[model samples]
Target: MSTDGVGFGVPWQVSAFQLPAEAPGAAELVTRIRELRARILFDGGRRPDFRDGEDYVDDQELDFGAWHFVGRREADGPPVGYVRLSTPQTGRLFQSRAFLGEGPFEDLLTEEGLGTAETFEHSRLVVEHRARKLGLGVHLNAMAIAAARCLGAKAMIGTSGTADGQDLFHERFGFRPVPGTRRYVERYTEDVVLMLYRAARGAGEYTALVEQLEPVFSTITVTPERALGDLPRAHGRAGSSAVTIPAPGADRRMDAEVWRPVLFEPQRAEDRGELDALLASGQVREVCDTIEEQLRELVRSREPGRKLAGAELERAVGEQLAGVDPASYGVWAWYPWSGRLVHLLPREEFRLVRTDRNRGRIERPQQRELMARRVGVIGLSVGSSAALTFAMEGIGGAFKLADFDDLSLSNLNRLRAGVHHMGLNKCVISARQMLEIDPWLDIEIYPAGLTDENMPEFFSGGHGPIDLLVEECDTPYVKIAAREHARRLGIPVVMDANDRGLLDVERFDLEPERPLLHGILGETTSADLLDLTFDQIVDLILTMVDRERISPELAASIPQIGKTLSSWPQLASGVALGGALTAEAARRILLGQPRPSGRFYTDLELLTRADRSTVA
Candidate 1:
């Protein structure tokens, strides 16, 4: 059962055993194969009438004359693929006899002048889903066919499931569907076709395979493992999904695991192979082809007055890229969460073209200074928009996002997300959106949300301390705690109430002694805020934002909290404005502008008042 073999130049250990085999390890191997069949065919494939079980076996599997062929990637590896070959020597008839009835089954054999002794049936082919793209199915099929030929059989027969192109795969090996034998099987819940392969009309890949294995058919050791090097190589790569398939019960919330994107530089030879294989894996849903577009912008940024149009712009881009190999020109950024491979200009050039539109408003020196800063954001609801806005404006080259709550249907009113993102952590959703905007951004997410343990790391991790903090969470303790840390670390903080368009900026970097929330909560610490009643916390937030100036709509909605309304009222318009306001204030503060610690308002309702007069 430990026979070493070669299949199409891939080293594989092939094993074969008759039912009721008493050899050592034979029973265990059979059990493993049965379990794989049950899980893949019965459970995952949704075959009917099969209860969840550890193993699957039909009456045909118990026949002493039936033989099983199993293939494994390693000598000691568990079986990854299997196929069964049954002959007439078994006392029981073929499984297909029941489907076609004895009359039609025997009549078809007689019409072809085939005798029972010279014919065999192959069925029960199964391959692991992860290994399907690696040509394991073809190898297993070749093993079954080679063994059947070695056993002196002149013809092969099998009932192939027509679902998922299984019958078509068999056709490549010279199996022809027996006329009028295609019918649906209740157990499989799919149409099945009886296929036949005769020795006299030898054809297809199976014929070449049997001939290739003829020399090693009698020998057990398949030496120089590349024995089947003459065979055509299989197409496609295995396990190529951009999003890695997690192991059973694995925790997917680890921020470092799923949220970060990997960059592949073409300079390394090994990375080139890896990138080529990745592209061939079919896992990347979208490969951003904006390299030339960005290149055109790069040229425009250097020569702003040059008017290159149509083919002229193309020629300029071509001239710039003339000496560079297309594959090695720019780096590729792969985002696993979204399965997007983005081709971008080298880091410096990418930022230059990205922030080109802000040339006049944000001078080159100011923009460069802003891009060097790091920002930490807590509470991803409104914070999601703020983080994305910061990215688009090139306000920060690195960001630390924190959010313990998931995106819910109710939060969709103001948050920038779709229904598919409902169950995802807000930090993850925010990081993904920010990365999509600028793949070169250094982003770290706290899916568990902001906590005492991670608060320090959020402010200052391996990438160095953040220059600015944006406090946006509803939790009173976190709000106070984040500000306390910011004051101690000399990091500036900004917040948008999403009501009355109130944008709160605290220049802790300049005034570390500034009382929390402008002394609204005098002598209050995060610990004190933690134990306050829900209403007390709400009052604290209201007082900090100036309760008297609260918007009319929000003032009315406050009494409805926990009674008629589930939460405070917020509109998309307010959230959008909050992002814009925060981004503007952050830019000025990071660049050492004279924006002081205070709460400013741009309330649209008041600003766009119907009857407004100039105040002298």
Candidate 2:
């Protein structure tokens, strides 16, 4: 328990004191904290299993040697948050003796080789419901850790509820989940996991917060409206000024420069400086060693028509590897977006091995021809799947991805992205995914989407014009504008409506004067659609899609767009089929297979109707 008269000044105060505190106003502060905890944890029938009255009480609250860290709006205000630090010196600990039984807890300590005296327990963290988002919970937790470490503790342990992803939140702060030990607590009606935190394994954010708080605790007093000014802003609250995230390795913004993987060839002396700088920054989190497997496959690919014995294969591999520097044999690729360093075979051999499986159907010459072309994609929701399929199949060596919207929770239904990718520009997400598949690919991104300003550059930028374009945007103006540019550049365009797998291909290269959407728009120019109202745009889109031919489910749900449904619905199956259809059209067009400008439907509902198929 801390004896120091430490308390942060005005707007907010964070201070700790031993149980049965002697400081002025400490008893009232304890009463306020207890009231807050009961209101949050027991009110509204939250703890129905407790037959006792709404007054929640923990036996540890009366323990003498334990300490309580309290947070408030002002120096002597009602408590908004609370955390308890139970030291081993108290002769009574919460997690070891009570949470986990003494016998099993002793075995765990033996397995981990942890000394009781060097560890502390943090438990019973509670923040007012409305104040939880104000970062008071995080601040209280940090202060608990700071208090523990200040008292000569080396580790901390706690029990975390799993219902609201609290355990995952604790994991981000360096807590390790105890394997096979999760149990449900009836009082809270949620699974609880035991967690331990060692200083050496602390996350960067937690470590930084601890370091910042440790000095404040030692100083005995802090005088600031906001004590820890560097803490994260209150969630959902607008900041008064721009605030940069200060924790190392916490930045997830994938900009244009960082999206491209940096290649390092050891044989090239000029790459030394870049490699050294990357290492010095300590950003490389993973080093992948898969070159040996690639080399073995490379040896096998060179003699495709013959089978070699085990000894002969080894000898051939040895001959190919003779005098070859292991470090310089291939190339080292660094992905700044993911902090990964990978070793891969050189470009030619890598391509040969990668596409070796595509032999008979694609043929080596056709594969080479396909890989030489560049494809541009717009609107990366459904387009992301098409772009990735194109990458995996080696359909294009270079790609241009464009999208203005960032990923959201709703996009996960069809987009190839995770929850962590939310808020990232769709173009950057797609570019990073494609590059991960084939590091040799050349990709350019337009995070601003296809606008009137960058329309020309998107069509014919840098190393010449795109051979094909896959436009899948929903904006009426961009859709019409992109097609106008494609027609002018003589580039072919492909699109998937994602309903009934409706695929539209316009070979503007062949039919220079063909009307957009095969005359469906009947002279609706991009300029005319620019300033249209939302309702007008929807009407126009439905007209272009020929609403009569849309899927039954989609047609039925159209009337509920805003009243019940947030937006038009798309399924994974439909999005996947869209990718395949677009890829097939683009492949046939690029290979000069004479696919004319037309709208085609591979509708599964129509193809596999029960009335139509009775062969069995």
- lDDT by candidate, in order shown: 0.73, 0.72
Q: Where's the lowest-lDDT run of ten residues in candidate 2?
A: 238-247
How big is the positional error of residue 30 in model 1, measured in Å on the Cα after superposition?
39
Looking at model 1, the pairs that clash are 403-449, 404-449
Tell me the spans in candidate 2 whose CA falls farther than 4 Å from its real position: 1-250, 254-257, 272-281, 611-615
Error of 1 at 469 (Å): 0.8
The deviation in Å at residue 457 for candidate 1 is 1.7
Query: What tens-digit string does per-residue lDDT give for candidate 2 at 247-308?
Result: 12333431222455666776666455545645554667888978877887988888966686
* Best of the candidates, TM-score: 1
